[model samples]
Target: MDLSSKSGGGRTGYNPVLIILGTVVVLVGGYLISLLSPSLFPLAASAEAGPIDQLFRVMLFLGGVVFVLVEGLIILSIVRFRARKGEAGDGANFNGNVTLEVIWTAIPAVVVVFITLYSYQVWVDIQAPKDDELVIETEGLRFVWSFSYTDPLNRLAEADTQNFTDSVLHTYVGRPVRLKMETRDVNHAFWVPTMRIKQDLLAGRQTEVAFTPTEAGRYRIVCTELCGGGHGAMYSYIQVYATEQEWMERFIDVRVERILNPPTDPLTVGFNLLNENAYPCSGCHVLESVNWAGVTGPTLNGIGDTAARRASANGLGGAEEYIAQAIRHPNAYIVPGYNSGVMPQFGAEQDEPDAVDGAYYVYMSDDSLTAIVTYLCLQTATGESACGDEAAIRAAVEAQ
Candidate 1:
């Protein structure tokens, strides 16, 4: 073998079939991963998801084919056209194949046209709103979310529109809901993992998005965009119901009935109040088990059990004094990462802990505060506060 003609002649030993097969294996492996990546694929679905999925599949197949064809030809030519042991001057120096060139150009143009048409359809189907769609307005802040329901009618009514500033809804589930989102402070994202829809709530601008939930459970509303010091805590939830009637029954009808036939457990009233309307605390804190979760404030979820890491960290004997003080004087020991001095004093409000503080703390009655506290402490992990994880609870106080 001469090995003189590197361009055209006896095989250069490059194997196109082997190259094509190896590439096919890798492409198939990647395609399989795409199909199984639920965490990424389950984001949100509308009519768009189906079309987008189809478009992606088609594109993937086309891309794989193109790769095989191009690489296969290169490898085949390198080996098949190379000069033999001692071949001629310039083997096969003929003109290019016009037919092959036309085939490649025409195929890509046709493929692009089809892609453009299919993508347009998907874009239209997802962006267009149906006439019967439910409309909601969302207000986002540092660590909390607010939702307002627009009346079914085209007319805007304050009475019908739940004033997020005054009374934001707990966000009923079910129905095809459309949302208009905005932010009060910084940039935030309105994301519901289950529904697979999340949109930016840009300050001073209204952003629009929509979703139709299929389940009757509550899902977290997380902020995909970083907004403030308490970014991690910037989450809320939206409850989805099996049907519209079920939604009303759980969020509205039941509340009225409970008000008429009040429960003996004060926590009942407190939690119901937390869900009834958007209270100020609903935006800045999280107190699960009693439905008092606001993103800006530290989560009060499971506060009923009572021991907290703070007292434990300081080696304090008990957590009650600190818990009470934290509420009454939130500024006294502001959580390290939080912005200081924004929380109003709840001291005067706690005077009558037996009362419910459903309204804003500044003007809420003592009964409201007590009821709020009573409801909030249920998730304390230690029957007093969420801050009291037994291990950390012990460590917190002992460390000090």
Candidate 2:
């Protein structure tokens, strides 16, 4: 039972070749795993995405190295240190190594500090304001997103109004964007997966997010937070144009021109208003004309004919009156299968006195409401308007 003779005369030796091979394996394995990052994420469409993705890859590499090292050691120990057939007692009895403990502790502490500094720098760089940043006013309602933009050049003082609003966030490559976001009914989140930017839209206060588009493509914008039953339908897009000239010519100039010379046709204006997501209808209804596929509310496939029947059944004056009432005061007559109070009240006034205390209220100008009604009234199988005329629609909306 001489222990020294069994332990090779008590001389402890290290395997240099094994150490070098293990280090090489750890480094190579980590690098190989990091190479899969591009496939793991959507296209890097923003300037911020580059650094963010790099940081992710760094962490991934470190994680892969640790994983390989730990699992490899575990497997090696299981095979190399298993008890022999005649072995019976405890394997090895020794005090813990303080040096080994210190090495493990110091390594993790250094890694943590490095990661903290690296992550903070990335955040600071991404959040820093850029020159000529386009400021967009973003509103996140229960199941929709609306983006508003003012003419950056201030060329149209005649149309000194709030400029224009659209459902899509439009910009050009290399242009920085700052989104000032607010929520109408509940908490929501504004997220652009390709841009790698997300910000919360609180109920009462406003929040903002910034990013610079580095690519020209349409990127999906989604509400990552579960705000309501229609959260899944809360999505839009960031339309990044290839050049500033293309953005101005295609989107900005077109929208501004529409504002400068307002369309006289109520149907065109109404279709434009709804198509641009002036209201949150797309999140709750299925209207094929505007490509709305919301499942929360009843479909509006043949709403013109449906409105005439509804008016007749409910003893309303006409289809125009019924449509007006449905838009302004939805709970007055609920569709048979749909629940009441789900749709927001589109009041004519900014602050309607008759609006329910806790209900969602959105302002709709008399003109816009009339035009919307007129447009919706044309959704019949016969391609004819169920409502009488423009004046009649306005009168009906006013009567509500």
Candidate 3:
């Protein structure tokens, strides 16, 4: 068949004007789509969020334009070169154009270079630590987050149990805050959607991320990394104060009192610790006294009596030993109906490497563990002698 004679116009039928017009249409349509995509982002509350959103919008526009151009060309070729009626032969035959290939390849290379430089700049700006930046040390465990605000003069205060000074992350509006984060067990990401900052918490090393909150509101702190069974509940709140005075009055002053006049009573100490959400117990147990309504684990309404009796039957020391064993080795004795691996190992390190889903890393001291047990042992149904006596319980706690 004579393909050139059939077309009559020969290769001139390929219109460069039409190709240019189509390219323009795809580019314009893609840009418009990108501009509209910023609506998908949540409210921006941090200073860094503005630039981050800007970069995102730009990338989205570029991506949309490319998508439209590629798909448009594919559809155009399909329709323009479709098989004609009664025509059963090759439409056209031409060798690949090296010039066109080179042009397309060079275009993406240039675009990639621009994107790399722009993204690197944004990264540098967001991570640059500013003067007077408040430092918050963050530790991510199985299903809980611990924040420690260290005193500048006494940097070693975190190791001092008597101080009990380290607490939640609290800041004032416009305050530059840097978080030195690490994971106690597995990998976890610290994310604040409104602030538009996210970083991973890695084990054995410290990672840092910084942001300046611009709004005065309570923001949700989420663990984007899937650590384990309680991953869904691994969240906390960041309270941004309106002013420095307000922040000092609310957070600083309270933390000061907690450190200087630390609670001495064992029961009060245990209650305060539990109520502080330091541990992930409330999410798995139901305790009316503490207003915990979680049903993930056995009810703690009368666990003291049950635990003490179980300890005796198991030939363990007493309630304290039973509770301690449970925290360190949750799967040692599973509840009748509940599963064995439901709870995390609160005070133990991960034995196997990279086995994060079922294991965790927690830095729990004997004193702290005993205090938590002391608190749990008092969860009596009728407020009777479920843990025997104060002297006996103390003896059990101090024995080992």
Candidate 4:
């Protein structure tokens, strides 16, 4: 057994200079290998994407360097310090070196601090509010994302509401937009891969993200959080118009018309609400009248007739009471096959001290809740019971 720095074959243990050279070569070679595959990432569509991509590349380079160094040392030890053919009982044996331990530990600590500070700066830059930035309110629900657009300039002052639309997010190239996001049921992450922005939507509080689109095209808005059963279908879109004129013509004008000259009839208003996702109902229910194909909840094609029967059978007041109760307390009477705790309680208020079934949550206003129930009551497929007259619908709304 050779315990000294020399072996039986008269060979030197190892060369320090050669080991350093090999490490440098492996690191460089690994970096080159990553560069050869140029199509690893998707297209960058926002101004913040450039800096984020660069940061990712730097982190990747550092990771590759570490990988090469660790694996390289293992392979080098096996090849250079292995036992000779039936010649050695043991090779050199020594305790660990304090200097090498300190070197390895200090290197990682410094690298981590450096990366954290660098990434923090990028985050601050991206989040800083810009002058004249457009603000959009984004809501993440069970299986869809809804965006509300507020007009800052009052271009369409004649419109009754400040928000023209509440479903789709609209933006223009080179325009800085800030999203005020919230979740309805659970935690959700609003993610735009091309824009390189992702933020969480928490219940009972607001989170935000800001970005300036650099490209003029449509990009997908994905919910990166694992929210629920229908999380996979939770997606939306952002339309980046090429010019200000195009954006105004496509979005502003249409929004103004929608608010200023809304449908006067209740039927149209109800139908539009279900179809255009004014309340995110289309994502949970299936209604053929407005082409709503969501299957998360029960079908509403003949809910009017069913409401009256369910009311009578359950010893409720009437059809109006049943519909209203269904909206306010969704879990009160779950359908035969449907599960409870899925539908959101719309009329539950913060001040309402009484909690039902150990559940308390934010709910919708009386007016909005009534309107939705009125619309649902008008949906009668059989037409045998005369689908609650307009007076009954109005009375039900006023009863709330």
Candidates in order, TM-scores: namely 0.57, 0.85, 0.77, 0.72
Model 3 stretches astray by more than 4 angstroms: 1-9, 13-20, 84-94, 141-144, 151-168, 183-188, 202-204, 222-235, 280-321, 336-371, 377-386
Give the alpha-carbon lDDT of every model: 0.57, 0.84, 0.75, 0.74
Q: Ranking under lDDT, best-scoring first?
A: 2, 3, 4, 1
Stretches of model 2 off by over 4 angstroms after superposition:
1-14, 77-97, 184-186, 202-206, 313-315, 333-342, 351-358
What's the lDDT for candidate 1?
0.57
Instruction: Compute the lDDT of residue 346 as modeled in candidate 4.
Output: 57
The number of the candidate with the highest TM-score is 2
Ranking by TM-score: 2, 3, 4, 1
Residues 307-394 of candidate 3 have per-residue lDDT tens digits of 9888989998887777777776777777788776557666434254423345454545555666677788888767664564556655
Relative to the true structure, candidate 2 reaches a TM of 0.85
| Candidate 3 clashing pairs, residues 3+ apart or interchain | none
Writing each residue's lDDT as its tens digit, candidate 4 over 264-311 gives: 566566665555555655556788877776677888888888888898
RMSD to true structure for each model, in Å: 10.0, 3.9, 5.2, 5.3
Error of 1 at 327 (Å): 5.4
Q: What is the per-residue lDDT of model 1 for residues 1-400, given as tens digits with 9 covering 90 to 100?
A: 1323345666444456765676676577556645544335554433334555666666666676666556756876788777888787876556698986998799789989998998778666655787667777777654556676432332333233332232333344445678888776678887765565657888779988876565556567788997655566656667666667766566555544453455756566657666564345665766654355566666666444433457577564445445545555566566776765445444453243321222113334344444554555455544544433334333322222
Worst 10 residues of 4 by lDDT: 353-362
Candidate 1 TM-score over all chains jointly: 0.57
